[model samples]
Target: MFLKQIVHFSKKSIRLSYQFQTMSTFTSRTNIVTGNNEWIFVDNDNFDYQQELARSAFADMLHDHERNIQYEKAIIKTLQNLSKSMKKIHILDIGTGTGLLSMMAARALNQINNTSCSSRITACEVFQPMAKIAKKCIEKNDLSDCIRVIDKRSTELDLENDLQGDRINVIIAEVFDTELIGEGALRTFSEACKHLTIDNENLHIIPARATIYIQLVESSVLQEFHTLKNISQQNQRINIPNDCRHLAGNTIFDLNLNELKDSIRPLTKPIPIFHFNFKHINEMNNFTEEKILENIQCNYDGRIDAFIMWWNLDMDEQGEIQLGTIPVWCYDDQEKIKNIQWREHWIHGIYYPQESKIVKAKDQVSLYCFHDEYSLYFDVGTSPFPPRSFIPAILSRSAMAAFNSDKRRNKYIKVLEKSFSNSSIKRCLYFGDGLLLPLLILEIYPNIELIILQSSNTHLNHCLEAILLNSTIKLNYQIISSLDKNEIDFQTIDMILSEPFFTKSILPWDNLHYYYLIQKYRSYFRSNIKIFPQKARIRCLALEFNNLHKIRSPVKQCCQFDLTPFDEQIMKASLNVDETIEPQSLFEYSSKKPTLSSIIDLIEIDFEKNFYDKIEKKNLEILFIENGICNGIAFWIDYELNENIWLTTGIENENDSWINYSKQGVHLLPKPIYVQSGMKLQISTGFDFKQGQFLFDIIY
Candidate 1:
């Protein structure tokens, strides 16, 4: 019997050891070979690793002093009030990422020092990695004894075993997205109240209530994302399909509405639409579906293109300590607005109605605001419109904005018309993700044979085909998935053009894949094939971002509690997996160019020349003209259509503001460096053609 026990123990130990070995040995590998044909193979241990990191914008939330302070105040207030009555208090922190709130609760309880009242705080985190980190953070702050870190989600926690049968009197949670209930907050709260908490009238929720407010706006800038407009050229017109025109994209544009002040024209004053009381379990349970009809008086005479949505949190029970997500213009006290905390975690959301409405000043319009358990939708007029099926187009708002830009569309039109008129372009090849340029060219010269290199996205291909079928013009175009010599007569192709877009292109330079394609199919092309963008230039500028830097900044401490463990883990993960250069819509982020050098052209690639002909390296020196802290280096592409026609995906005008349409590449520095006037900075930049990646290093 002893021998049998020894053998069983040995087998168990071996199994456990094997499992650990397998986990430790697991690794991710990526190989990129850029030669005649660029090849990339990526095998990752976890496919969602990068996505998980990106979605968990913890640093951004932690850096939000306003949110932290408000939460801390609310927690402290709740504890103080609860301690007055209850002999023992139990606190439950739901979705406790990094254990910030749990630590706050522990500290709050400690501060109260109510000898009669004892407190037990339990923090539930679903993400195991984050849960472990939270435990470490709690320990680092010396709150391990006071707070219990549960690896399971709040719903998964057993009241008897996990909670030791302690009835939760106070529940603190921040399970909210840009849209108030989008993150399953209703279900979470309802389930907690039903299963996790004891049925008691004195039960308290930190955020006692929430109110959703919306303002009608007339924004031509936002209209492009929801509907496709007709394209007209030289008496010929390509009409958008009726279905496509009315298709209200299901996507909610969550952004900092303050930055889009120039784009949005307010049609109506902000009105409270939906109110949810978190403190009442019955209220949250009954909030499964709701439709509120509001008669809003329009203040401006314009078309109602969209509605801007924001929410206010009544953090404390008394409703005095409140947090609002309203934009700057909504506030009457401009001075108070300046002091209001800016947070990307809970920015305003824009919801497009199924169809836009035209309203005049003093006109009372009936707006129906509807919300289910997880999503919100709206309709204009007396009755709610019929639910419309989502039809995918260029779903990316940035891409839609780029295609809708009159200035950009005109540039492509002019260049295409001039090229067609000047040259004997019998056949043309379109080699980009965007269909606007190809459609425009076809509209101008229908007789010209066009071959479109089909994008990787199958949905986009289907949408393009539908548009083509709906067009009145007899179009001669073929969208081929690949450049097969047998399928496509490449030698007969006259010119290659693009909006220079690619689904795979995350950074601005990723669009350089257009040139890479040209090089790949150079052998099949005619000797003197014309390229629409004759050359491409990459430009760089040093910038000091206002609040954008906080996304990557570490949260060492929050509410006087040490959060270094969370910071260290995030920093390590970022160093290992995060991209050096990230793509950001710079228009949304306010940044100032350091008084260093003017925007410098880093490198220029001539489409006519072979990309792999030579290895490119550049070393440049820039001197600062004034003292400033440089946090980021912004880079953008300039496509030279001709000697006179140049299209920039960067700062277009002399005002130095980035064009709102396209996202530019920004390389955030590891840390902000303050530079004195006349300080020389050395920049070493290179393009690795073999790997199809750019390398940049700045040294002072």
Candidate 2:
């Protein structure tokens, strides 16, 4: 005996229309109210009040049973106008979303059948969570004989052979999309129509056509939203979350969707990212696109929630528009929901454009909207026009380090900028990385360019793949398990050393030659290297080895320095701590001591804030690229004489503790390399130390 009211109105046009919601009797406590006017409402009074407000059956969605009943009456009126020669009708309801549209269609068929409605109905749903609830509502209505609910999608329609019949004459699909591609409508309905429909014999509720319209919008809220605080502390995007970790508490003063990304079920969900209606549009017959040109309006004020639209079918005017609904449940723990002063249950995003002057409604706009994501973006076109402009976007932060120095970039910037003016190079290769100088170079200077990232770790392989897919920047990287960019097999290095390469010709790692020079002097290394300096010399001499520290001794002490003749007792060190603890268990606890370098590392963190302020103000463009799996990353940074640029990398295997603890870390250390190709090498650190004088273009 419950009644509800529903209103049917256009979300885009804001036009008032006659859509009513009338609820039919059901055994369940909640009743869905669909209006002949345009609103869809549902009542869940039986559910706990708090539950409805929190995550609940009704989810605080607005509805009325009486309104739903009236809407059903209007739907019946529309169905009656469709055909004249049928006694009974079979219907296939898609998305059965809330079970309201299907229910309306069922009630209308019953009116035409006289006395009562007894036509078969099949509801196809894909989400297990949604399908379960819908099945209960269908069974509670006592329409089980006529309406059968299946927990599946239209793509899997073959399993619903029982729902198909020769006399079946109606397919009521309410799955249209504003931009036919955003919602799951096209994928679901197209497949269903191909298999389940009876050609042009029966009436399709909304068979074809979706003309998407769009224009630029500016909002201040969007700018502020993009400035989210960094949590993990890594200066890279791969460190981003794969799940909804948190939500904004108040109105976002700013917004930015360009960098906001997430993995989800599909686009059918209409992820509301920024709000803007169509200012201009061009349409194709069915599911077409048209661009309304206008200036890009960005905000210094309010935020943008997401682009919004509602797509409806022309199959029957009796059917109402299936408006887009924001499923706020996508966030973790409902962390995304927020409340305003006037509305308690209504959840709204910040994309409402405040000023209309941002983009004119009549101007032709560019269609290459989401251009920065490495897509094949095409600029807006004129009638019978070939698309204008094509290039890729999405630059890596690593690639721009070169241009970070305004003072240093005077010459490089001019070279890159001038090169882009020719427009002859359809594709160019970027070699370096770090601050994404290459990407900015491509953007500032118009040219088709590709960037190759070289990495020694597999950690960024997948992220790099996603970056290639989403950004305008292309990737040429490798995913290898270890260092050795030249594909130098360790076995080969071992083989070469074993036969002709000579035992003394070990590939220099960590400048071990310096260690050899230090060991020969014997005076400095004898003590720490052996503790008993004389014994250390004897061991080194007897072993005929330039380096005794690398060799495991019968002793318990092995330090960074070699023991010379000047020291006391020889401290035989053991690399295997577990093995050493057996002989000296008591000493092991106090002896988990710091090495020389570790002792030097205890200096309090240098809060050298703004140390690079001068360098950061530069307009330089640096390209950093890492060849993934195949080689190392080509990351770079603006060169500074006073500040040292440290290069660090993390591999996928860092997730393991033993591998991590065993010293598998950044391949390139904080060594000073040359700054510019034309500049000479200045003595930075290693001239007197080791690693030899770094010889390069600025050759001494």
Candidate 3:
């Protein structure tokens, strides 16, 4: 009865909660909207609760036992030291998402004073939904009497009303991002010290200090994401324009460097770049901007491509409790470091220099590191004091990676060369967002006429034009921004091809837009036309993740505090708006393949067939070969370029390894199911044409 009542209450609360929606506008004259007359409303509530809960990093951070225990130890030590000198103690937690840190302080105070009535603990969360959840969690842990929750930003707090005229002696916060200062940690600390706390010898901060470290490396793989590279087809070469070769965008690429061990070659040992003391407000104020020059000797003879950055935090005043984000290669005990807790919230940052530098062994190079209040940039040799403003690139980092993939480039070249070798093929049409595939076909047959169905991105089209003009070979091609019949002679087109990539594609199967396009425009093409990728298969496999599952897992307890209410809210939100399959870069995450079943083909699409004719429901069964917990099902698409050649956006080996360029689709189960050996499971899968998505249901 109690469980039923709780479920009923949760449903009621969900309905009462306000849903914030954004009103999109069509600014382009080409965009046409046909609908009834309606006035869209707007407000200050710009938050999307569904997206927040789906992509929340709270669960991932909480699952890190090392981080949680270190924080608890730091808080206990701080409170213990304060109890010796002060009669009254007040603590403030800024941006407390789940009240875990606030609860830790409350519990530690109770242990020190036998009763927490002598001390006050206040927590502020600007997000109302999270503030309510935090209050419920505090009540669940029976710490409501000691800890106070305020649903307001720290900058909006009133010292008299919110803090009750009690000057806070200690402040706790976790506002650091991958770049440490990118989330405005310095601003938050400066404001809290000025308005929320008292200036005294007893004033304390949880993370008293932070030190950043960087190491230069020469990696051709990393260089692909920073700038455009020249492409060669047969004896012809397509050169990148001078303006686009060295251009680097301002976006930071943050990922796990441990997975790319084979790709990166360290050119120099790690060196300290910058250090900031968070305990002192005056010191933080003085850190608005600074430039440091270090002379380092190179250990390897290679071109310096990029720098890898990570930081370590001194959590307590004594600096005994420390947490670092160093990669395995940096430590002597690599295996022990790998065994440590993995955290995605604080990963390594990969920063590219304005230009690549060639260094010899024992060569001394002058490294200049510059940092503003919230961002970091680097340079080599004696250039200007501060680096020049970053020039944005037309292609994103991911798009460049796809273009730089050697495997993909080789396959496409072979297929295109074979097709163009036939003199009978005169005209062709290319559809997709890839810039290189289209160029490769043009280079293979310079005299053949080609029409490109350009993507919605105007910048990509500009870059394509620039490259074509810069190349030595004269190419015959036309780019059509929209699918207009009058723009080209579609009936004369002999072949159609695609890289099967779309700007709006979010999942592996979303690229089925190619198939949909072929079906929709079948009347315009010739009856005997050729398709580069004749068919596609949707494949799936059962697997278990090491720590990726925690992103979607429910947190029942964290830091000795019950979080049932938080879990219930997340469940309700997920049911309403969360997608079953999400796109993830599987290469950065670790997973184990199940011993039960081999890969299964859930759906197959033949571009030559009609959509309705190929739609069918499938019901299959599989038996578990070994006992293990099934947590997720991974999916990828395999494109058959020819009778003997194939390409996949998933694992390419028997060892369950993935290609680093593309992201795969993953469906995490609501709850992990334990299966015994020889246990049978049923799977039902199909496609919903109306929604333009695939569906799957698994039963054990």
Model 2: CA > 4 A from native: 1-74, 83-85, 97-100, 112-118, 127-133, 158-160, 174-180, 206-211, 220-315, 318-700
Candidate order, lDDT descending: 1, 3, 2
Candidate 1: tens digits of C-alpha lDDT, residues 559-603:
787888887877776776567778888888886653344677888
Task: Report the C-alpha lDDT of model 3 over 1-700, residue by residue, as the tens digit.
Answer: 1111111112101111222233332111110111012233323123256546544543577777888898899999989988887778889899898899999998898888544347889999988888988999899899999889999988889999888789889999888888999987887888788887888466899988889889999999898777766677446656778665643375578888877777899999998888877756444445555565656889989999999999999999788999878877887886776686788788899988777889999998877776767788777765454445656655556667777888889999888778777558898888877777877776666888878988777777777788888778678988887667886778899988898787556577777778777777888988999987999888887767777888888888886688888888877767765667878888888776543456778888778987653446789765666678878778888899987678889865435678766778988888887877777679888776544568788864
Off by over 4 Å in 1: 1-55, 233-236, 246-248, 281-287, 292-294, 388-394, 593-596
lDDT of 2 by residue, 346-411 (tens): 222222122122233334322233312111122222333354333122221111111232323343
402 Cα displacement, candidate 1 (Å): 1.0
Q: What's the TM for model 3?
A: 0.90
Candidate 2 backbone clash number: 151
The deviation in Å at residue 378 for candidate 1 is: 0.9
TM-score ranking from best to worst? 1, 3, 2
Q: For residue 140, what is the lDDT in candidate 3? A: 89
Candidate 2 weakest ten by summed lDDT: 532-541
Q: Estimate each model's TM-score.
A: 0.91, 0.33, 0.90
